[model samples]
Target: MHPTTTNEPPQTLLDLITDVLSLLLLSTITVQSFIGRWQVLRTKLTSLQSSLSSLSESPLWSQNPLLHTLLPSLLSTLQRLLALSRQCSSTSSLPGGKLLFQSDLDIASSSLSNHLHDLDLLLRSGVLHHSNAIILSHPGPGSDKEDLVFFIHDLFTRLQVGGVEFKRKALESLLQILNTDKKSASLVVKEGNIGYLTGLLDFNDQPLIREQAVSAVSILAASNDESRKIIFEEGGLGHLLRILETGSMPLKEKAAIAIEAITGDPDNGWAISAYGGVSVLIEACRCGSQATQTHAVGAIRNVAGVEDIKMALAEEGVVPVIIHLIVSGSSAAQEKAANTIAILASSGGYFRDLIIQEKGLQRLMHLIQDLSSSDTIEHVLRAISSLSVSDSTAQVLSSSTALIIHLGEFIKHGNMTLQKISASLLANLSISDRNKRAIASCMGSLVKLMESPKPVGLQEAGALALVSLLTARWNKKELVRDEKSLMKVVQMLDPKYELIDKKFPVMLVNALLSGRSSGCRKRLLDAGACQHLQKLAEMEVSGAKKALQRLSGISLKSMFSRTWRE
Candidate 1:
């Protein structure tokens, strides 16, 4: 009888492999005694044994589903080969016998070759690596601190070597872990998993994979300085730039957020520009989803701190992009866009002029009108203030009647910060002779702002704005007409008030006194400026004695006019 064939099914992948290898060895030994057709069995059995032996080294091979499926086919094919070899060894090759057996031998040989091909494919596909990793590193269910360490390491291995499905599952788990535990971000970075995470950004065929990858990166970027630096050093920016350039709206949004956090360091700005990301960022601001536009503008704002990149942003037409965002984007987008405008404008007059050219002032006014958030309004106000600092820009702002009215309202109703920036911007606009009357309407609000005991910057800015407004002949009369405002201005000069800058208040007195109107002089006397001016003169404060002299002359002139009228 032929050696007894074992019909028992394999209990494990190792058992299947062992059975297949044993059958191949028997087939090869039996074929060695056969004639010409037997060589086919010998050659194919050797190839099959070599492929199976390669997998035998992994202790977890039985856990791999692929090997389990393919190994059984190898066993059946080997049995066929041994049977055909036995036929060839025992029966002489008569013409009819050769014809009958040749077909069976050919079929067995082809089956062995096909099975070998499948095994080769499995080996090359990295399924072995993925399977072994999964078997060893699969995490326990509990998410306590100790278990998370296991989970993190496990997920990282999956990310590094698993197939698309495994990577997706791993990324989902990683996102949850990262979102709830801030410390895990550093752990990921410390383990050098950022490279694998960023590598997923290139998986265009797998959008969910890329989406989760970029989301994880954003968390890591925002986690700590060390993570941010490592991400940059690990080529994360290039991947982010690619996403900004061509990724879907959601991907772009996540990439922008990551870039925003990374660029917060200021030192990372040049790399973004070097990668040609500035223009792509502008495109996002112009056309991305509302959330994407918001974060993209924030990234641009952070990157604009670098001088070269700041110039590049201006050259790439970020001004109009910002203007568009301010006009049409969501409130969050407008806030970041407005803040970006402020940063770019502050760099130099060229950028400030570019903002003006793009009709940025009008767009900002629209945003400010619709905005209710104090923080957003503060960002817009900072932009307005930066633009208004330039003489040319101030003249443009002076022409916006709505804006002038808004400034008055901000000063009257906004919080301390709004009051400060508003007064500062209004002061900037008032420097132009044509803007004084238009801005002078805010005198009462300015005086009220000046009345606050703290934040001397607001007080100084208000005083300065008022001083500029006093230069206008009509404004002098207006200030005199508002007795409360006049009294606040006069009180600011008192030595006991201890104002940081008494010069502007002294100039206010001199301007009112120098005017031809005796009404202002009479009003100053009524507001009790004479006593404060006298005290300042004794202290020898700059311009205080000259202001006192002017006020005394006005007093004499008024007295003579009273005598003449009598």
Candidate 2:
């Protein structure tokens, strides 16, 4: 039976349990008229006695409100049974005859069985042992932790054994606790209450219950990977997808967020795709709320990392919706959309052409100028860099003076990651004479990066970009004039630096030698370039012997000897 709230003073659970036990002792009367019924009633009472005795032994029993609110009703029923038993024993003709009271005896017996069932469920649920452990860990007089544990377990009990109204109230309280206490939330996962929580997602008629259940589950999903794994193992994804399909806006948004977190793990990606969530997620991106669009796109972003899932996402027509988001969504949504496009575009030119067909590059260029957050810029830049790898797309990107300038700024002033990526992009963009001229202004900044002592990625990218530009005679003239930059390029060729790719600097020197200018050759000799080139030649490094051959016409030994004589 559900506990009733009343104006009357409440009895403590201990007092009520005691009254119930004593009432059971008093209920041992044998009726003269109904011999068989009396025996049956006695057998049920014995079972109730044993169950109640075991329940009272639980350390949390006295503190539990469900049992407290319930015991008084049991006492009332026992009182009626006792009075009826006394009546059957006392007078030959009673206030009510045996046949007249048959229904009443049956009612009493059925109510006792129901109460016994509720009690046995509470015991067998193992909540008592778990809650008791919580209490012992925080033993104190009315400590808040102790009280919270009691409330959490009671809510779990109600969720397990209580009626609809009881479960509803329990879910509300559970969400409230979950919102405020992170530790308690961890406790719920630890105690394996996720099944109970996810169970409520199927409450079709109860939208509020479903909302609250997903809300709690989303919290748990975001908590850690273990909680997410358990949620998927328990089949929460199907219910979440159903909510995305048919639930209210708020529920749909939450389901998307949970999906986002769940799919963050690469292993969980195929399960969502197998469940056919890809279409729902794309639909959410098209029409869901800003937050929903953000996280749904985020889920897509996570899953799109897998090779097969990447194709799956692209085939689902995610490209157009993602492009739409990049064009119109909020900053976070745009960032995620950009990242998803980047992942897809990194795979091949097929995705790049799709993005371009959707005018993704144009929209991404707009974001590069409009968005302000560094993280958002980083994601947008990453997408652009990946897309710009295609020669056709590189043509489109190089046409944007603003993008080339931004790449320069990012390489010169942005973080190391941005610098590396931007430099690589510049290397791609500088393949054309027109793009090389447009990118010539970034030459000094690239040289500055190459001068940095560590982080071979940035230095290597910088060298590649500068080397790509050095093919243009005017660009080579500018590099030769910057003697310090020229010396840095030569020093990078030393084998002791163990640079990732020595070919970029070697290529730069070869380009500088292309003109066969004596001044440039003399500068290379003064900067100790001859020794480094000779060593590289001995090692048979690509282009090293070629660079030395270019210098052969200058008579390297006599040139240095002539400079020393001067």
Candidate 3:
């Protein structure tokens, strides 16, 4: 569903980030008494978190009666433990915190003990249980905990009196309403009704009720922290897994959507995988309807972003299932499937080798040849980019004329990331002498990309590709043919290129000046490239000075002092 793109780590990633941040927090904690409570609670929280993480290994963890009884109670404590132990500036807790939030770590670290009693109350409040009444987020009149009690009392009375069909409509309507707003979604999930909601999925004859349950849980998981945290704690994912295994067709589709939403956070991704979502999603993509396949692929995409989870998927042999979708599934399914493969392949080394060994690149190239929608193009470009990083994969891609030409067009112009990635692939493909012309076809785009804004790494890549293109006699003439093009090549020598200390671009400058074409030489001079060259020649740089001597000689040096200074 790609409702949004994110690279921000979930709470699970905090252990790593905190380890890095802990060195920073060390002196701060030592100076004040803040170390006392923080050290104790942090250690306890660590133990609790380790316990929770183990549960993510399998649903069998849930079947242990001792664990099943203890987990629900411990979850609230863990939630409050995590929440209270946070550095005051926790970006995860604070809105807009990821980009610009710094916490008063001293104060937050010191205050951990004060929350023990409050946490006890919060946990005793039964924050994870499922019930019938709707819990409203509004703190207005008749909306407090007492108000909820009365509503629940009244709701059960009506449910007992209402007939079966009437009961189904009431549950469906509540789910519909809850799905409408974060407020309602938050209330339902935080109030622990997700367990009750998932229980409805077991009514074999009531698919609508089951579908609504899946849809509502999807909404709740997507809403905000309260719902996300509480629902996930209550084994909401295990419930969804059950639905995927046994529900009717429409119910399966909704369940798939809900599973994707739940696993979108990396914290939940491992839990679902432990429950065997990797195999189920693979089967769903293979056998479900097009929409079901699409959503299932989307779920796979999210779960696979967790590096270990992706490794598990590869281990389960679903890489072939995903590759199969690129050729045999609907366009939407292919797009998500391609994206899923792209992320896995991007994990590098073993992942790339696995895809290549699976003949994944061949299928992806086939996708490029046969499919041309914007979405499909984006995914295939990403996929090929990952695969092409390998020398062997690069060799396969170089042989595909369709891929080179299509990618050249994309490199020349597309979305920011698409153009940058396309240029990178071209750089790799250009390693093969046979593929330089294909990349050369996109010179106009490459020239512009060298001037692209910060973080592109495009200039280095574009220059490297140009160096390869210039290896062929005509390509040097082709690039130098336009005076603006000649200058753009010269401009790449600016020392600001952070990739490789700008050495590759300097080698490119050397390539341009040392070329055999008199026309290219004259055009280089005409475009004031000698000014850039003389500047480099005078510097202590190795490649630039050697390149100048190879291109022109002491006569140009004489001209440099006379003409360049003026």
The lDDT leader among the candidates is 2
Candidate 2: where are CA atoms >4 Å away?
1-50, 56-63, 68-121, 124-151, 307-312, 388-391, 430-434, 451-459, 498-501, 552-566
Candidate 2 residue lDDT tens string, 1-566: 12323322434443544565465456555467686887888888888778877876777664444554456666667766776777777657866666778889789878877788777867876555543321223223445765665566566777766666677777777777767666666667765467768888988787677777889888888878888889988888888888887788999888888889888888889887788888989999999999999999999999887887788888889999998998889988988988888888887878988988988888888878877777778888888888877777778787777887788778767887788888888777745666576667778788777766567677778878887777777787777788778877787888786744667678778878886466677778788887888778768788887887676564656645654696
Q: Ten-residue segment with the worst summed lDDT in candidate 2? A: 131-140
Estimate TM-scores for all models.
0.67, 0.75, 0.65
Q: Which 10 consecutive residues of model 1 have the lowest summed lDDT?
A: 1-10
Model 2 TM-score, all chains together: 0.75
lDDT of 1: 0.73
Look at candidate 2 and tell me the lDDT of residue 198.
Answer: 88
Point out where model 3 deviates above 4 Å.
1-169, 179-183, 190-192, 203-211, 348-350, 389-392, 430-435, 438-441, 491-505, 555-566
lDDT of each: 0.73, 0.76, 0.62
How well is each residue in 94-202 modelled by candidate 1, as lDDT tens digits? 3456566677777877877777776665554444544443333334445565555556655665565446766777788888877766777777777546776778778
Q: How accurate is candidate 3 locally (lDDT)?
A: 0.62
Q: Among these predicted structures, which one has the highest TM-score? A: 2
